[model samples]
Target: MKLKNIVISAVAALTLGSTLAEVGVGSKATVDAASINSTAQTYSYVGTSYLYKILKAAGITYNKFYKDNKITYRKGKPEGIVVHETADSGATAYNEAIFFNREWSNISAYVHAFVDDKQVIQMMTTKYGVWGAGAIANKRFIQVELAEVSTRAKFAKSVNNDAIYIARLLHQWNLKPNDAHYDGSGTIWSHYAVSKYLGGTDHTDPVGYFSKWGYTFSQFYQLIKYYYNLQGATTNTSSASSSSSKTSSSSKASSSSKASSSSKASSSSKTSASSSTSSNSTQAAKATVVKKTLKHNAYIYTSTGKRTKTLKRAGTTFTVTGTKTIKGRKYYHVGSNKYVVASNIDGTLRTLKHNAYVYDTVGFRKGTTVLKKGKRVRTYGGRVKIGKKYYYQTSVSTFVKAGNF
Candidate 1:
C-alpha cells in the first residue's frame, strides 16, 4: 500500500518545546507520534510502519535501483544520533544510494535513516552499523545523512527536519542525546574526530556544516551534557579514576629507583675513560712546523709561515707570505682575511669547483629556488640551491642540500 504524506506549513507552531525541556539541553527532544503528525509533515502507509512510511512519503523522488544495496541491523540500545549534511542534492534515489554506499565503506553499513527537505530515505536497518562515523565506533549510534538543497528556505527546512528526526530517534531508542566525536575524550564525537582515529582526515561532515549555521562546538557539548543528565546518566569526568592513584604512585617510584642506580654506575665508568683519553692525546704529538694550503671565503692560500691574515682579493688566488706547517690540514684566507679550510667546504655548492677560487655571494638565499626555471625546489631549515650557485643557510634561505651550504 502507498504511504500518505503529511505536509505541515512552514509557519506551524512548535508544540514540543516542553518535551524539549524534559530532555534537557543538548539532549534529544521527544515528540508524541500524534504531535509529529500534527505539527510536522508526516507520511503514512497502510502496510509500511510509521518510520518507513514517513521516509518513503517525503516529497523527494527516490531511485529504485542502485548498486551495492544492503541493509544491516544494529545490536544494542543506541546512544545518540549523529547528523550529517551531504553537500550533494538528492534528486534521484540512485545517486543518493551510491553516495551512501561509498561513505559507508570504512565502517559497517548501518545508517538509521536519510532525510532531505522533501523526503527521507532509509538505506540500512537501524539495528547495525551503517558504515557511518568513518572510524568511530557506531555500535550504539544512529547516523542520519541529510540532503542539502540549493535554496536558503530549503536549507532551513532541512535543518529543522534533521533536528526533529534526531529527536525522534532518541525517543525511540531511549538513548542519551550526547553525540560522540571520534576524538572526544569522554563521549561525543564528530566525523572529523573519528577519521583521525582511522588515520584519515578527509571526512569533515556534520560539525563543519552545522558550524555554518552558527552552531559552536561548546553548544554541541552543552546539548550532550543536557541529554546525558536527562537520561539519568552522569557525564564522564577525569577524576572518576582517582581511586587508583595509590597504586599508580607506588609503581612509578619503584621504576624510578631502579633507573637511578643504573645511571650512576654508567656515569662513573664514562668519567674515568674521559680523563685517560685527554692525557694520551697531549703526549702523542710533538710541536712540528709544517706548510699547508688553506681556503677561506672562496680564496686559495699557500702558507709559508705561521701567520693568519686575510688574503688579497686578486682574482681567485691569495698569496700567503707567512711561514706555517703543511702537517695535517691548513685553511686558506679568502677575500678579507677570512680563513677557511678545504675540508670545511660544502660539496653541494655547485659554484665551488676543485682548485677553483670561489666567493661568498649573499648571506642567504631568499624566496624559492627554481630549477631549469620549471621545477621549484622547496626551501626548508634556511637553505636553498639555484642552478650552479649555492646560497647560505639563513632565515631568508629557501632551499639547499644538507651539509652542502
Candidate 2:
C-alpha cells in the first residue's frame, strides 16, 4: 500500500535505451511470442498441486477471506500474473495479508496473493481485478507479492514456490510460460515492468529487491518458463534447437565445435542433412557463399539460434555460407544449417576455452537436455542469467552454474 517502500529508479537504469511507448493500464501490446522465444510445453509438476494445498492450509480463499475483508473484485478472468516484492524487508506473507486487510482507504492497494518460502496465501481472487498494479494493471492482471527472504537458500525456495504458483495460474488460463515473454505481449511482468510496459505507477519493486541478491528479470522469467513447460503434456526439446542466440566465440570454440559438427554431419549423414536444414524447411534457397573470413570468431549456432554449433576461428576463412533470419536478424548458415551472425565475422581466427557443453535451448528447463558435456561442447560468448543463477549458456539449454566454469 505504501509506494515509498518501493522505488522506480532501478527501472530507468535498466531500460536506458528502451523505446517502449507509454501504454495505459489494461492495454495489450500485440506481438508474436515466437519472435523472442519458442512456445513452451507442459509436464507434470509436483509443486503445481502442492501450492493449492499450502494456500488452503493458509486459509486463503476468495469467498471465505477476500470478499469478507471487503476487497473489491471485477467480473472477468485474469490475462496474466504480475510479480511484486514487498519492499518491506523480511515481510512474511501473513504480515502482508494483515496489512491488506487493514488498509481501509477509499482506494486501497491490494493483490491476489503473497508468497513465502513454505506457503502461498491468497489475498484475493484472480478472477477479479485487485488494486496492486495501479488502476490500469489492477483492472486486468492478477497481482502476486513475493515476501522477502532472509537468506539465499530461503530466497531460492520462496522464488521456486512462486514459480509453481504462477505456473498453475498460467495453466488455468490456458497459456504457456513463455507466452508471457511474447514480443510486447508477455503475460508475466514485474511491478517495474508494469509501470514501463503498462504505465500507471512508477514503482520498481521486485527487481530492486531481487537484484540485491543478484537475481534478475532474465532469471525470474526462466523459472516461470521452466515451470510453465511443466504443464505441457510432453517436452519440446526439439522446438528451439534451431534458433539464433547470443553472439558466438572466435577462438578454440570455433574449431572444436566445427570439428564436432563435422563428426555429427558425417555420422548422421541423411538425418544430419535434414536436421541441418534450417528449421524453416521452405526458407528461400541461398546462394553458396565461398570462403569468407571467419572474421569475428562469432558463435556458430543452429539457424534457429537455439543451439550453438561452436566458435569459428577469427582468421580462418572458411567457406562463406548461406544466409537466413529467425525473427529479423540475418545469419549465415554454413555447413548444413550451422549459423553465425552475418555481422559477427572477420578475416581472422584463434583459440579461447578448450571445451564446454552443448544444450538444447538457452533456458533452464529439462527439455534443454545436454547434448554433449566435458569435451566436444565448444561454447562461444558469455553467461546468461536464469532465475537468480548466472549460468554460462554453454550451448543451447546447456549451462554451467556461475562458479562451475
Candidate 3:
C-alpha cells in the first residue's frame, strides 16, 4: 500500500510538471488563475448600489477562456479601440456584462476597460477580443466604458478623460491615426452606426454622450488624427537614428521635417480655432436676455369693463381699459392706471381676458387718465360706460364719483 501511494504521487507530479512546462513561466499562468476567474465572473454585473471597494478588495478567479482572454480574428490583424458611454446612470460592470450576455446573447461587442471618475477597471485583455465595436466584432478593438452621469460638467470630464486614455492607449499600441476606430476602412464605429450597418437600425452610444460634451463624430476622428500624428512623428524620429544608409536617412529626414511642420500647423490651427470658438461661446452666453422682475401696486380689472378705482389691498380688482407694449412687451392698463411692462411681471402672467380684473398687490386711483390707444380715459369712482355695458371696470376699493363735466 505504501509503494502504491508513492507511485500515484509521482505520476501526479509528472503530470503537473508537464502542464507547467507547456504553459511556461512567462505566460499568464504565472498569475493566480483563480483570482482572474473571480474577476471575470463578477465583471458581468456591477450596478449603482454595488460597493466598488469590496469588489476591488475581493479575490478574482481567473479564466483564460473568458471574453477578456479570448481573441478572434477575421483576417490576421486586430482592429482599433471602440469608445462607449453607458446611458444608464450609476451602472455597474457586472450588470452591464450580464445584460450583454443574456439579452444581447453576448452578441454585442466587448469593452476592455470600464472607467469611472476615480478608476479604470480592466475587464478584458487588450490582446483578446471583447464585444465593443458592433458588427465589426471580429476586428480587434479595445472598448472603454466611461462612467458618468449625463450632466454637462460630468460629460466634459468624461470626454477629457476618454481623450487622454485613448491617446495613451494608442501610443502604447503603436497604432496609427488611420488605424483608429473612426479613421480607417475598418474604422471604429458607434453601436448605432454598427446597428445601422447590420440592418437592425437600433443603436446609438458614444455619439450621444460625445455630443453632450460638444464633440461631433468627425471632431472625435480629428482628435484621433492628432494623436496618430504625434505617434508617427515619434516613430519617425526613433527610426531615423538606426539607419546609416544615406538614402534612408535623407528620406527619413525629409518625412520627419514635413510631419513636424504639419504637426505645428495643425496645433496652431487648433489653438486658434479653440480660442475663437471659446470667445464666440462667451459672447453668446453674455448676449442672452436675462429676465427681470419688478413689484409694484396696480389696479386689476375684475368687472364692469370700463370703471377704474384705486386699489389699496391685495384682493382689490378694477377694470383694465387698454393694453400697451413698453420695451417690446405688452401690459394691461386699468382705467387711470399706469402701464406696467409684462416683462417686469414677477410670476407667470396669464393672458389678459377681456372684462376680467386680476387683483393687484398695488393700488390704483380713479379720475386718473392713463394712456389708452395713445389717448387717455377718465375713470369716475364708479363703473364708466365703455363700448358695452358689461365691458366696464369696477373698483374693488373706495371710489369717488367724478364731477359733472
**Regions of candidate 2 where Cα sits further than 4 Å from its true position:** 1-75, 104-107, 179-184, 234-405
Error of 2 at 161 (Å): 0.5
lDDT of 2 by residue, 1-405 (tens): 232233234432234234332222121211221211121111111122223454467785323334544333344566677888876676787776665655523335667778777557765556667667677777667888888888766676677667767866787677555433224377787777676667777765675566555555556687676555533322121222222333232222122122222111111101112123344433523553454433223566775565574544433344544555554445556777677554443111122233323221222243334332233333323333433344333332244543434
Q: Which stretches of candidate 3 lie over 4 Å from their true place?
A: 1-56, 60-69, 92-109, 133-135, 179-186, 198-201, 228-405
In candidate 1, what are the lDDT values of residues 148-187, reduced to their tens digit?
A: 5665455544444444445444544665555454334423
Superposition TM-score, candidate 2 onto the true structure? 0.44
What's model 3's TM-score? 0.37
Off by over 4 Å in 1: 1-75, 89-110, 135-140, 179-188, 197-201, 213-405
lDDT (Cα, tens digit) per residue for candidate 3, span 189-294: 4444443344222334555554444445455555445333322321111131110111110101011111110000110100011122321111111111122111
Assess each prediction's global lDDT (C-alpha) against the native.
Answer: 0.33, 0.49, 0.34
**Candidate 1 global TM-score:** 0.34
Q: What TM-score, over all chains together, does every model reach? A: 0.34, 0.44, 0.37
Give the better candidate number (2 or 3) by TM-score: 2
Q: Rank the candidates by TM-score, best first.
A: 2, 3, 1
